[model samples]
Target: MFFAVALLLPAMAAADPLVGVWKTEPDRKNLISHIKITACGDKFCGKILSAYDATGKEVQTPNIGKKLFWDVSSEGSGKYGGGEFWVPLIDVDAVPQMTLQGDTLKVKGCEHVLCAHQTWSRLQS
Candidate 1:
């Protein structure tokens, strides 16, 4: 099992193309979160590594280092589906889907039938 799992790690990493740090669009309060998206087996997950105020100054808050979303499965063709994202500001959960194009990612989710969408840019370094 160990050998088989080890052999599959490289393939798993290559399976998902949308793996990297992403800068989320500003929320209603004009705060942006830097989310690190990584591969989790066949799925993907993103966690907040840091946040910035509207002025681009890094802010230290309880939301830092929190899991933004997880279990995002690939739907092929630069699209992913079936993930749950937590909005710390409102303390609400929503089902999320994402579509990636170049360095931009379009994230969409719905909470209680209210849908929200945002565009996140890929972060280098």
Candidate 2:
């Protein structure tokens, strides 16, 4: 029983869409951060590849080299739970409930009841 279940785990976990670089809507002035996502253990994590300030100048932030998700184990079926997301735009932290749909990664959460949703596209390898 253990062996069978273990064999299935990898296949299921590998389906997450948050496994590549995601370019934000460049036309939308409000979105200017490009994210590159990869796997850490059984969880998915992302980092800011290009961060632009309001004036469109690249600025360095502490979280730039940080792990966006740590100890975030997979839940199942292209869904991941129990992960924290740090958005550079808001400069705040929030718990993320992320789902992988096709080539899109959807994340929704709130910071102190102020909710926000972000959709990221998967970059081609």
**Pick by lDDT: which candidate is best?**
1
Per-residue C-alpha lDDT of model 1 across residues 2-114, encoded as one tens digit per residue: 99998887577545668989999899878899999888876788899998999999999898988889888888798888979887878888999899998999999889889
Could you estimate the TM-score for every candidate?
Answer: 0.87, 0.66
**lDDT of model 2, residue 6:** 74
Off by over 4 Å in 1: 1-10
Clashing residue pairs, backbone N/CA/C < 3 A, model 2: none
Query: lDDT per prediction?
Result: 0.86, 0.66
Clash statistics: count for each candidate:
0, 0
How large an RMSD does model 1 have? 2.6
What does candidate 2's lDDT look like per residue over 1-125, in tens digits? 99888776655545555567775544234535667776665566777777566667876656566655544556878787677877555668778777878888787766778867877777653
The prediction achieving the highest TM-score against the true structure is: 1
Candidate 2's TM-score: 0.66
Error of 2 at 79 (Å): 1.3
